[model samples]
Target: MTGTVLVTYGTTNGSTARIAETIEDVLRKAGLTTEVLAARAVASVEPYDAVVVGGGLYAGRWQKDARRFVRRHSRALAERPVWFFSSGPLDASASERDIPPVPAVRRAMTRLGVREHITFGGCLEDGARGRMAGMILRSGKGGDFRDFAAIEAWAAHVADELGRA
Candidate 1:
C-alpha cells in the first residue's frame, strides 16, 4: 500500500538523476511518500519501505557507485521490494529495443532478488559527457532521447505493484 519509497540513482551528467526525479513524481502521485537521492548519499534503507535504483551506463557498465551500493546493501535490498534500471543508449527509439543486462547488474539483481530491470532511452547533451563519451555522443547521435511517456508508464506500474506491499 502507501508507504515510504526511496528512489536513488548514480549519474555521470545527471540524466539518470532526472529519471529518478520523474519516477519520484509518479510514485508520490500514486500515494507513496518518496524521496530521491544519489546512490552514494543514501546512508541507509531502514527508513524506506521500497527502493528504486538506476544509473547511467558507460562503456557497457553502470556507475561504480551504484554497483557498490548494491554490493554494500544486497542483504537489506533482498529483504524488500527493489527495482533496477540503466539509462543509456543513444538511439532515439532505443526504448523499443531489447535491453541486454550488464554482467554486474545481473549479479546485483540475483543478489538483491529483483527480477525486472529496464534499460531506458538516455539523453546525451553537449558538454555533458567525458571526452570520449562526448565524441561518441556527438557522432550524430546526441540528443534528449529519453522516452518520458514510457518512463512515466513504468513508474506508474511500479507504484501499482508496490501498492500491494
Candidate 2:
C-alpha cells in the first residue's frame, strides 16, 4: 500500500505545482516512490498507493481543474491514503478575511478519506496574473511566501506516516 505516492496539483501561475514537486522530493528522500503530475492530466488514481492533491486558490475557490479532478476520482481516491493541500495564501499573517476551504474541497476530503488539509502560503510575482490580486490582498512586498522548510517538514512527516502503512 505504501509503494507509490502520487503528488498531483493544479495551478494557475504554477505555485501549487512547485509545492507538489517539493512534496514529491521529500517523499522520495524518505524512500517512498513518488510521481508528480498535473491534476487535469490525471485520469486515474488506482495505480498509486497514496495521493497528495492540491490546487491554487483564487477568490475563495480552488482551481476548476483540481476540483474536477477530485470529483472525477473521488471514488478511487476513497480507497487509498490521501491528503489535501491548498496553496494560495498571500500573507504570512492570518486574518479574518482569509478564506476557508470551499465546500467542494471539504466534501472531497471526506469522500476521499483524506488524512489532513494543509494551507500553505503562495507566491505573487510581478507581471504574474496575480498582480491585480496582489493589489487586492494588500500584502506588503510581493514575493515568494512559500516556506520550504515547513513544506519539507510536512512532506517528511507524510513520508514517515506512510512508512508505517
TM-score of each: 0.94, 0.88
Q: Largest TM-score belongs to which candidate?
A: 1
The residue-level lDDT of candidate 2 at 165 comes to 87
lDDT of candidates 1 onward, in order: 0.86, 0.83
What 10-residue stretch in candidate 2 is worst by lDDT? Answer: 93-102
- In terms of lDDT, the best-performing candidate is 1
Cα deviation at 118, candidate 1, in Å, is 0.8
Q: Pull out the clashing pairs in model 1.
A: 1-163
Off by over 4 Å in 1: none
Q: Give the clashing pairs for model 2.
A: none
| Model 2 lDDT on a 0 to 1 scale | 0.83
